[model samples]
Target: MDGSKVALVLATSAGGVGRHVRSVADGLRERGAKVVVLGPASADELFGFTESGARFVPVEIADRPHPLGDVRAVARIRRLTRDADVVHAHGLRAGGLAALARLRTAPAPLRLGPAAPPLVVTLHNASIAGGLTGAAYATLERVVARGAAEVLAVSPDLEERMRALGARSVGLALVPAPATPPSPDLAPSHEPESSQDARPSQGTAAPSRAAAVPPEDHAAAKRIRAELGAGDAPLILTVARLADQKGLPTLLDAAAGWARLDPPALVVIAGDGPLEAGLRDRIAEENLPVRLLGHRTDVPALLAAADVAVLPSIWEGQPLIVQEVLRAGRPLVATRVGGVPVMVGDAALLVPPGDAGELERAVRRVLEDRALADRLASAAVERASRLPTEDDAVDQLLSVYDRVMRTVF
Candidate 1:
C-alpha cells in the first residue's frame, strides 16, 4: 500500500531473459512500484529496459566466474540495492552474486537496519554441463538455495532440485509465452490432453485435415523450401542455435537416416552459434541432406513452408520458439525435456532428449501420416490459445514478492 522500491538484477541475456525482464519491469511500473533494473549495459541496449519506464543501472554481471570482476560486480550490486525493499535476481550467476553481496555487505543507510533486504532468485535453466563446470554451478545453486528468501523455477525438475537443496520457499516461476493471435479460419477442435496422456502413437493414422493458411504464407513457404533445396522432397525445419545444449549433433544423426527415405527429406536449421564450424564440417564430410541456414528472420514463413517443425534440444525451459511453432499452427517433433512436455501437451510429438533414433522415428511418423500431422497442427492451435500472457507473469511475480516480504521482512 505504501511506497516501496524493488531491484531486478540479471546477467547477460540475448533473448528470453531480457524480454521477460523488460515485460516484468513494465508491469511493475504500471502498478506504481518503484522499479530499477540492474544488469550489463549491453543487455539494456538489446532489451531497452529503460524504455519500459524502469530506471536502468548498468552493472557488470559477467556470464562466467571471475575473481576480481565478480568482486567489482558484488560491490556495485551492494551499492545499488542498499535502499531496496527487496532484490530479485534472475539466472544462476546473478542470483549467486546477489546472495554473496547481501551476505558480505553491511546494511546501508536505507529502510532496514542491521540486515540487508530479503533476496529472491529465479532459476531459468538447469545445469547441463559436467565435471568442473557442473560442480561450480552446483555450488552456486546451494548458495542461492540457502541465501535467498524465495526461489522460483521455470520447470518441475528445477523446482524439485531447489527444494532438495534446502531453499526456504521454492515455487514454480511464471514464465509464460504470449498468446498467439487468433485466426478466423481456426476454431476450437478439441482440448489437448496433459503430457502424461500425450504419447507418440505408432497406430494407423486418424482422419484429419491441415489448418487453413493464406495464399501468401503458402507462397512464402514454397519460396523458402526452394531456397533450402527441397525441390520435391518433404521439408523438415528446425529453428535452434548451433550449440551443444541445442543437441544439433543428434539432429544431424537423425538427418543421416532421412537420406534413405523416398525422395530424401531435407533438414534445414536456422540459427548461428559457436558450434557452426564443426557442424558444417561434419555435414560436408558425411554428405547429409541437411542445410544450415544460419539465423533466418522469416520464421513464420519457414514454418508455413515446412512439412514438419522440429526442436532437438538436450534441455529447455519454456522455449519461445516451441511456442512460436504452435502459434504458426505447425506440427512439431521435439525432444521431451524440461518444460517442453508441459508446454506442448498433446499438441506435438514428444520424444526422449538426445535419442536420435526416437527423434528420427517421430519425424518419420509425422511425414508418413498426413492425418496424424493434421491432428497435431490442430492441437497446436488449441494449445497456443491457452498459453499465459505477459500480464499473467507479472501477476504471479507480484504475489511471490508480496509473500516473501511478509514472511521475511
Candidate 2:
C-alpha cells in the first residue's frame, strides 16, 4: 500500500452498524483505500465483510463499566490500527474501542512513513445514555471525546445531543446520515426456505424498501388470519425491538381498544428483544388480538402484507427498518423522533411519541378510511424516493473516508 493511501478501522456492536460500516468500507475500497472492519461476532454473523472484499477483524465490545474488557478491546484495536493510515470508528462500540486503542502503547508500525493515523469516532444515535446510568456514560463519552481526533455525528440530532452532553475538544462534524431510500422492487431474491442465508449477498444493491413486500408476505398475513379463524381481518404491523422506547406495551394497550365489526383487526408485532416474555404474557392476559413474532427476516413481506406500518418509538436514529417499511409503500403511523420526521417527511401519520391513544386513533383512521391509507402509502413512496439512495449514501461515505485520510496524511 502507498504510504499516503488510507485505511479504515470500522467497528460496531450491532446489526445496523454492519450495514453502515460495510457501505462506507465498500465505498472507500471502491475509492482505492484499503479498509478493514473491526466488527463484532453479531455484525459478522449478520453481514460478512470478508466476502464483501474488506478484512474483518473481531473486536469484542464492553458495554460500559467493564474496565477489563475495555483494556482488552483497546489492545485488540491497537493491533488492528497498526499500519493503517487512518483509524475511523463506525458507531458507539467502535468509538469506545478506538478510544481504548489510543490508550495502548505501540512502537509505530514500519509501514507508516511519517503520518500516524488520528483516531475518529462516529456517533450514530442521539441518546448518549438514559436514566441514572447516563451520567456515567456521559463522563465516559467525554473522556472518549478528549482522546479522539475527530467526532462525526450522523444526524444533527446526534450533534446537538453530544454538545449537550459536553463533548468539546474533539473536532466535530455533522455527517448527515447517508442512507438512501430502498429499491422500488417488491421482491427479495432469497426464498422463504433460504432466509438463513443471514448475510446479504456481497455487492448486491441494498435491499429495496419495496422488496419488503412480497406476494408470500401477503399470503402469510392471510395465513395468520386463517389461524385466528378471522377471515378478511385488517392487519397492522409493528416491526421493532419490543422495548419501552419502541412503545410496544402502549401499542398493545391501544390494540385493546380497536373494535372490529365484520372482520376483526389484528396487530402483529415482529422482531424481539428483552421484552418478549412480558409482551407475550400481556397479550395472553389482556386477550389482545396482537400477535408477537420473536424475530423474522420475513419483515419486508410482512410489511407488504399489512395494512399499516407503525413505529411508536420514543426515540430513533434514522431507522433503516422504517426506510424498508416506506419502500414497501405501506402507510406509516410513527412517533415523531430523531430523524424519523426526516424519513417520513409528510408521508406518515405522525403522533406524539408514547401516546397509545393517539397511536390507536391513527391506525384506526387508516383502517377505517381506505382512501387515507392509499394516500399515505402513495405519499410514503414519493417521500422515500426523495431521500438519498443507497448509491448516494455510498458516495457520501467515500467522501468521509477521503476527508479523514486527508487529515491523516
Q: Write the per-residue lDDT of candidate 1 for residues 1-409, one digit (tens) a residue.
A: 1367889999987677777788788888887789999999999999888765679999998877777888898888988998898899999999988988886542331233345778999898887889987888898898888888899988889988999988898988877654445432233324533322222222333112235243435445545766766766777889887877899999999999888777688899989988999999999999999889988767777777777889999899888888888878888999889989999999999999889999999998887887788889989999988888888888887887888778753
Worst 10 contiguous positions by lDDT, candidate 2: 198-207
Question: Could you list the CA RMSD of all candidates, in the order they appear?
Answer: 6.4, 8.3
Q: Show pairs that collide, candidate 1.
A: 271-295
Give the lowest summed-lDDT range of ten residues in model 1: 198-207
Question: Candidate 1 — what's its lDDT?
Answer: 0.80
C-alpha lDDT values of all predictions: 0.80, 0.64
Q: List the residue pairs that clash in candidate 2.
A: 180-388, 180-389, 183-208, 209-327, 210-327, 212-300, 212-301
lDDT of 2 by residue, 1-409 (tens): 2223343554434445567667776666776677777756667777767888777777776444566766677777777777776677766655755765655342321133233466667776644367766765665566556655567775557666666655542333333233444333333334542322322221211122232344434445444545544445666788887756687877887887764423557788888787899989988987898888677766655665577788988787677777777766888899988778866787898899878889888887776765677788788778767766656765655565556555632
Segments of candidate 1 deviating more than 4 angstroms? 1-3, 105-115, 178-209, 212-216
Model 2 TM-score (2 dp):
0.79
> Model 2 Cα displacement at 238 (Å)?
0.8
